[model samples]
Target: MRRKDSHDGPARGQGGGTGGSGVTAVTGGGETGGVTAATLPVFLFPSELLFFSEQRRCHRRVLTLYNPYSFTLDYKMLCTSPSLYRVLEAEGSVRAKSCVDLVVRHLNVSPANCGRRDRFRLEVRGGGQRGGREVWAELRGGEEGGGEGEEEEERKRRKPGGHQQRGLQLPLVPTAVRPSVSQWLLCVLLALLCAAVLMLPLHTDSGSMVPRCLHVSTNQKLACAYTLGLLTMVFLR
Candidate 1:
C-alpha cells in the first residue's frame, strides 16, 4: 500500500533588520488533505493469492471485488509479470452494492518457476476519486521431488516380472433396452392379430361380418387376454 498527500504552500517569514533592511525565509510545511490507500472503501476477498502447480498444469483462481457504496465503481487490474499470467475481465464496472469476480490464471506453471512471487494492483475510481491496493501472488509446489516420485512409480510399473494388482473389470450394461424398428413392427402385428381375435363375435345369433369359424371360443379368448397382457408389459418396459 502507498500513501499520497497534498500540501497547501511553503512557509514564509519576514524579519526586520537594522537600517530598514528586510530578510525573508521560506520553510517546508506540514501535509494537508492527504488520502492513503487504506482509506479507500474497496473490499477484496483473499487479499493474497496462492497457486499450486503440482496439482494441475494450469492453475486458476478467482478474485472477488465488492462495492458497498451507493454509486457504481470502476476497477482495473495490473500485474507485475504480465507475460506469465492471464486475467479474465481485468477491467469492469461494479454496480452499487454488488460484487464482481475476476479470474486469474497462471499460464506458465512448471517446476522451473516454482515458489515465484508477484504483485498485482487493483485500481478503483468512483465519485471523482481514485485509489488502489496491492495484492501478492505466490506459486508453490511443482518441485523436483514430485517429478522424482512419479518417475519411481513408473519404473516400478515397468519392471519385469513385477506383479501389479489390477482393479476388477466389469462389463457395462445399459440401463434401458429400447425396442428396434423390427421388434416394434412385430409388436404392432401381434397387437393387430390379438385385436382381430378379440373382436370376433362370440355368438352366431348376433349379426357380424366375420365368418362362423373365426368366432372366438372360451379357450381362444383366454389365450388372447394372456397375449394382450404380455404385450402391455413389453410396451411398459
Candidate 2:
C-alpha cells in the first residue's frame, strides 16, 4: 500500500542467479537447489565400446554408467547409427551413487562392417534441471586392423589408468568346447574294456586242462590292443 518497491526486481534477479545459475553454489538458502543442478559427474567404464564382427553373428557389450551424486540421475543413450545397434534400457534412472549397466547389441555384425566407427551420447539429467550434461563415447564395430606391432600399440593406448574406474571384461566369443558327462562315462567304459582285453590269456599251456576254444591267439591279442589304443587316443583327443 506504500510507495512502489524499486528493489523488488533486483531481489528476484539475485535469487534466480543464486538458485538457478549457480549450480555449484553452497549458500544456505539455495544449497539444495544448487546441489540438484550440480550433479556429480557420471563416468563411463572402459570409455569405448568394441564389437567383434568377425567372431560372431551378433555382438553384445555392456556399457556402465556410474552416478556418484547423492541424488538420483536420469540418463538416455543416443547412437549415431541406431539401425545397426540396439541399446537395452536406453533411457533409465540410476539411483544416487549407484551404477547401471546398459547392454548394447550390434545387430549388423559382418566382416564388411569391420573397423567401422560410431559414436554414443549419454545425456544425464538430475534435480529437475531443464538442461543436462552430455557424455560422448566411441564405438568400434570390429577388432582393430593391423599387424602384431600395430595391435600392440593399440592395446597400449587402451590400457586403463590406475585411478580409472573399470568394469568386468566380457568375452566376445563362446568358451572352449568341454567334454560332457556322457563323453566321460564313455571314456571310462572304454578304459575298463581295454583292461579286460589285456588281461585275457593269449596262449593256453599244453598241460592245462582249459578248453582250447577259450585260448586267445597272440594275433587276436595284438589286434585288440591296437584297436583299444586307437579308441583311447580318439576319446582322449
Candidate 3:
C-alpha cells in the first residue's frame, strides 16, 4: 500500500504529516464528526461569483454564488430551489463557510430543512482527504455524525504518515466500459454494416424489379452478399 503526505489545514505546513493529524473545531448546535476544519482552495467561474450580488439584483432577497466545487447537493432541494441550483451551476469557488451562510440566508432554509445539511460543513473542517500535490479533485460526502472518532483513528492506524486515501469507495459494481480502440472499431463496423444494408437492394435484382423498370437485386440475395462481405471485413479487421 502506498502512503501519501497528509494535509492538516492552511495553518499547517503545506506538506508533511502522517495519518489523521488535524484538529477541527465544531461549535454549532449540530452533530460533530471527524472532519477537521480547513480552508479548501477552489477555482470558480465568474458567473458563480455573482452570488454576492444579492443587494444589487432581485433585491437583497436573492444572492447567488456558483461553486465550481460542488457541495453535498440535495437533488430534491435543488429541484425545489431553481435559483439555488442556478447559482451552483454557474461556477466559482468561495469559502465553504460563506457558502453555508449564503445557503441559510438565500434559501431561508435551516439545516433541519436540507438533507444532509450538516455534512456540507466539510468546509468548516478539512474532513476529507487531501494529497501532497496541489491538484484539484472531488470528494464524496461520508455519513453525517457518528463513527467519526473511530473512523479517524482507524484511518490513522492504517497510515503511519498522515495522508489518508483521498476518494470514495463506490458501493455499486462499475459498468464495464469498452476500450477506446474497441469502441472505435465497433462504430466503424456498424457504420459499414448500415451502409451495406442500405446498398444491398441496389446491387441485386428481384423478379419485381424487371416489371417496374427498376434494375435492382432481390433483398434476400443482397442480404446474403452483404453478410458475407461484412464477415470478411470483420475477419480482416
Candidate 4:
C-alpha cells in the first residue's frame, strides 16, 4: 500500500561538503584525508663516517668543486666545529671550466668518544659564481637512530622570527626493547617440541641412532651428557 523509497541505503546530499565526504564516511572525514601523517626526519644520506682505529683508522672523504665560468675560481672549506672533524688541505683554486677534489679527514678519536655526534659545514666561494655553495656534513661515531631534517627546518623558522630555540639531538643511550608475549610463547612451544622429540620411547628401532643412555647398565655419564646437550640446544635456538 506504501510507495517504495527511491534510495537503497543512507540518503546522500543531506549534509554539506564542509564536514566530510558524507555522513556515510566511517572515519577520516573532510580535510583529515588531506593531512599528512607526521614522521621522524632523518639525515638520510649514507656516508662513510666511523671511528675504528684497528680496522679502518681515520675517515676520509672527497668533494668535487666545479667552476663553469670563463675565469678561475677560488674555493675555501670551513667547519662548524673543527674539533669534531677537520678539513685536510682546505684551501684550493679551481681553474675555469675545471673541477677539483676537496679532501677531508677525521682526527684521531679515542674509543671513549664513541657514540658521540657532531656536525660541520664547508662553504665554497668563487668570484665567478654569484653565490657560495655550502655543504653540510655530520660525524656519527656509532649506530644512533635519528634524523636531522625536522630540527634544521625548525631552527630556520625560529631564527627568522627571533624566538628562543631548542636544540634537537638523538639520545646517547639506546632505548631498551622488551620481548613481546607472542615471542615468549613461541620460544616455549619450540622447547616443548624439542623435549618431546628427545623423550620418545627409546626401544623403537627408528631411534637406534639416538644415545642409548637409559639402556646402559654401567655408565650414567653418557645419559647426563645427552640430557645436558638437549637443554643447551633448546636454549641456543
Question: Best-fitting candidate, measured by TM-score?
Answer: 1
Clashing residue pairs in all predictions, respectively, total 0, 0, 23, 1
Task: Show model 4 residue runs off by greater than 4 Å.
Answer: 1-58, 115-117, 127-130, 141-237
Candidate 4 Cα deviation (angstroms), residue 143: 9.9
Error of 3 at 93 (Å): 48
Residue-level error in angstroms, candidate 3, position 136? 46
Model 3 Cα lDDT, one tens digit per residue, 9-83: 111112212222221222343223222332443221121211122122321122222222333211111122322
After superposition on all CA atoms, how large is the RMSD of candidate 4?
28.3
40-154 per-residue lDDT for model 4 (tens digits): 1111112333433333333555555555555554434444445555544455445555555545566655566555544333333445333333344434443232333445656
lDDT-superior candidate, 1 or 3: 1
Query: Between the candidate structures 2 and 3, which one is better when assessed by lDDT?
Result: 2
**Better candidate by TM-score, 2 or 4:** 2
Per-prediction CA RMSD (Å): 16.5, 18.4, 23.4, 28.3
Ten-residue segment with the worst summed lDDT in candidate 4?
Answer: 21-30
Candidate ranking (lDDT, best to worst): 1, 2, 4, 3
When 1 and 2 are scored with TM-score, the better candidate is 1
* Prediction 2 global C-alpha lDDT: 0.56
- Encode model 2's per-residue lDDT on 15-53: one tens digit a residue: 222222111211122121112233445476656666765
Candidate 1 structure quality by residue, lDDT tens digits, 1-237? 111112322211112221111111212221222222544656777788787777563387777776777766777676677777777656656666667676778888877778888777776888777776666788887523544456677887778777886566799987877889999999989988987888777854368787777777878877987998899888887
The parts of candidate 1 lying over 4 Å away from their true place are 1-39, 142-237
